[model samples]
Target: MNPRRTTRSSSTAKAPHRHPRHPHNPAGRGTGRLLAAVVAATACLGVYAVPAHAAPAATGTEPVVSRGVTIPAFYNPPARLPAADGALVRTEPLTLGLRLPGLDGRPIPGTATRLMYKSTDAGGLPVAVTGAYVEPSAAWKGGGPRPLVALASGTMGQGDQCAPSLALEHPLTIGNKTLSVGYDNLAVYRFLAAGAAVVVTDYAGLGSTDRLHTYVNRVDEGHALLDAARAAHRVAGASITEGSRVGLYGYSQGGGASAAAAELQPSYAPDVNLAGTYAGAPPADLTEVMKGIDGSALAGALGWSINGFAQTDPSLRAVVDAHINATGKAALADTSTMCVGDAILGYGFTNSKKWTADGKPIADIIAAEPKLQAVLAAQRIGRLKPAAPVRLATGIQDDIVGHKQARQLAVDWCRKGADVTYKAVILPNLGDKLLTNHLAPLLTDQGSAVSWLTDRLSGKPVTSNCWTMPVQP
Candidate 1:
């Protein structure tokens, strides 16, 4: 789970489906340029880290607006939730921080509505999740009713302000309020430009103030995504309908979310007309994934996982809390309030060994503690067969998120008779530990992934490559 950053000033960058609810690539030398740009830009990030303006939500329904960023007040759930999951909570006009106006004065990409909808968490409790629904002004040339895409974001961070809905409004934000790079805006607009409706979930507890963002919790993520689709149909002006062919798109953390949703759709959200799914570098096995990024550029994300795991499972929390040292506690506290960019610049290449009371890395601790291992095992995504056709891809040289485990997900699905298309992306090691191998493929393979999903949305069927996929690497 991670982020591929983009910026405006220079810097960068949600749900559960308990009840029936809604809801790529590698390449190129440009990867070298991108890696260099990131390195160059990071050295100066400290100067920009100022304190943000604050607006507390103690009494009224008011957003926390700081700099240009906003965490909408609508995120607050009512004390009473509707009987059905995916029930609409509220909606507001969401203005895009970056938008192109056509000659006629209409946003060329689309008009967006801020959404708060009900979704069941992994614990089967009702939660209010926030997101954005975009109705494209562009015409659909590829198909039937305009296809609806539920776009799941990769690892943003653990902060409430890091929500993708807010990012759509403020593409670049920094300082105490948040440190973000909204690279996903390009992906959002791409689908809009293709004449598709898009709904983006903020996930349970992410934008909502009820709890901590449960990062990489598969059931929670799957339910949130599926519920977003269910709620999309309720948006008053949205072009999305129950009949619209639904496509899932995600990479990194989002990859796992989309993959989970793909499997859960048939049972948890029978109403969602799922057509195809693209899961790029999915961390299907969290045990392996947790070890993969431990000392990489975005090592702070490990704290996010711990913070999330602790929030949902008291057993996991007990284990983590007992073994964690003061350094670990401080790191978790710091990362819980940061975005991916903040994590990268601050905790890059730091070892997890520094966090443990016994000076052992978390993976080793889990190896010694079976209770923690069970938590990770429960989070695994490959056990169930994914619905519809799925395109799973991974970078061969990825040091973060683990390429082998991602490919294994495709193999697992293939064995269970799911239609699968697997791609092994070959990329030069642009950075030894700077995340180039993992992040590069996201940018390079995006076009091919989008085309693949669009083809399925357009009713074009693809043949499965399962027969040729051998276990050997």
Candidate 2:
């Protein structure tokens, strides 16, 4: 989801300046200090209403990533977690603002919880993952136990401060964009309005403090999403049980997670009775997406992906070092410390040739290497059949994650004998306009996608349209 820059004066102190993404609004730099004193005075006057769920009093020990920074104690997982995957580690009550970024000004009436749960990493090592659970204030009018949707957020940058949990607490502004006012929060509000309990995964490393987020790593993302559903059921005050009907929803980065979880559910979490999934604008082929973003507004995303690959895969690291030029090395280093806003500002519409000794995109370098190709192939979706029906939506002229590869996903799954509904959004005007093609459908098609998943969760019969669709090239 593309964040619309915020219009508010910098009355708020930006989260810390450890990252280059935190550009100080000089006009509002010290206002937060004044506001803090006002809050203290107000507390002394005893005029403030208490939050529904009081945060725990104990503070968590900071991790190496933010050694000198202060983080709330709720993010800390227990020192020891059960060896089993999908085990609930610990939970605490959380309260989000009534008004969030994309809610169209409609208040979100609900009880929220922050959950830390056990899940496997890409290599099957047990690790802790954090997520938020919301039991809607809206009543369930559908039927049976209120359904649960594991809502995964799209690219929120790799910064810990950009984590959705923190954004839900106090919106972080990237440039002028406040994260709490974006499409991800809007989607959560919609789910709650439909009377579904929602659990949003911060993904493996994004909120872990010590870990460098893995970005597009499929295994880690899928594991985190499925395990989030497991943790949601165990959350205190949540009446959801193992038998509760489950669905997955996400777009962009989130689309990748939902798609991967649907495929992994058969083996990784066979106990979860998944109803359906709606994946919008999923980067089905990371290699293709990497090439597509090389010189675009999101070119920094390519750097982010490369940085993540180097962190997790040793072979890829060696290859990157072997061919990367000095300029490329510095840019990559700089990208590591910045969030999406700074990345876009620094690297947008820039050529990848400047980064390579051979003057070619990194994708070309990886394509030439069999080992690197294998690494990317492992991250691709459609290798396994989804256990449940899937609804996939992509704009025909999407420039970032091209429609061709996204359409190919439907083809691959259909051949694998899975039921898939492929909807190709036709927006020639938006497509001709450049990047808006990819983002427009996120708003337009979301309601339909939600309605489709809601139908499945309500136990309606699914009619597969795979055979009638044209074969993707």
Candidate 3:
């Protein structure tokens, strides 16, 4: 069921079509002269010239913008959720623009297209969560319901700017950096080709005006997934029939998000028809993840845990604000906009020099902070069985989140009588190669995971091997 290798297809779908001339470009004297000449030439050929200011007719090429305005920072939530029950809602049209605010409360100046989805908050008010969908291409297919693949992005040491949207839209395509892979739109492209709709949540706060991303917050992650699906279906005029299947895929930070989504869907979004989820190398036990990656190559992950917990629980931040030195405070701020590489390069090799005084390890500093300890303890994911079918994969040599923890999660779920399809691969020669070791199982085992989803969409009965477990380590 696993894909033998990962490769890009040549005939993949392109972005929607657009006019040749730039719409925002100014018409100056020289430009006017050239336009006159072209007009004369057109007249000679018996063709009528259109006015420069004439509005171009709609071509279905434009992206759909959300109906809601950007959530202002000072805005407070109403006592009830907005009423969002309608046949399908379409938002205004918007050309790609830059400097837009993302869910993280930071200004991300890149090509963006917004869409509105349908949902109802706890109070039964019709609710619509705005989506700032961004991709590199402008020639993507504009019609039909594409496969919806909700990405659970990994933890970026900093805040929301570290979101995958940055790379997906404005990739580093020049020089040595060019050799480096930018954003991974492969998942989106793959599902799109399969005629599936894809929606990548900015999580609750990463791309919105919210102050924090809520990191491993189960409720927040669940809300993003459920609401995003509703939004995509509404904006795209796509239908999520009773048999419509949904799949969740993520790694590390995203893995945690996917796992939480799977666990919370039954109660949180009982209506969401989640067929199956693919959780790769999730940190089921946050405590172990914190302890294991404290000062190793993956140590940069600690920064995300710090920022996420600080943003979710006020008590956690008070502890951090008190224990961290001035340098640590500065580092935390800078981490917000930094990418994974920047984070690892800056603080990976070095210990929490900025956060601690007297040369103490960063973990020790956190351990001494009682409030932070409670915050870290709150992020754990266990004692809950995921309602949807799940396909969990992990590499035996994984060093970031550790394979043992992933295995333990599967065991816990199995014990709870939940349907689980767990796969553990022997990637010994891989060492601590995080990406490959973690993702290979998911990508390679496409037959089981993705095919299973296809079946769910078709309303086929689901079968699993949850009763069986691999021999103990």
Query: After aligning candidate 3 to the native by TM-score, how far in Å is the CA of 431 from where it should be?
Result: 4.2
Q: TM per model?
A: 0.88, 0.83, 0.67
Q: Per-residue CA lDDT of candidate 3, range 125-222, in tens?
A: 34433443432221223222233556666654333333344334333311211111223344544544455556666565453322334556655665
- TM-score, candidate 2, is 0.83
Q: Tell me, by lDDT, which candidate is best.
A: 1
Error of 2 at 152 (Å): 1.2
lDDT against true structure, model 3: 0.51
Model 1 lDDT on a 0 to 1 scale: 0.79
lDDT of 2 by residue, 1-473 (tens): 11111111122211222233423333232333332332343232212122333233353333222211223556555668788777777777776744444354433557788878889989767778888899777766676678999988887776554566655554333222211122377788888998888999988867654456788898988999999998888887786767778999999989999999999999999988899999999998998988777876667677668777777775577788888887787767556544554455556566688889899878789889898888888899999999899999998888887888888888899999899988988776553313467777888899999999988888887977898677532
lDDT of each: 0.79, 0.72, 0.51
Q: Which residue ranges in model 2 land beyond 4 Å of their true spot?
A: 1-60, 63-70, 76-79, 99-108, 172-181, 429-434, 471-473
- Error (Å) of candidate 3 at residue 24 is 43
At residue 219, give the lDDT of candidate 3.
55
- By lDDT, the candidates rank as 1, 2, 3
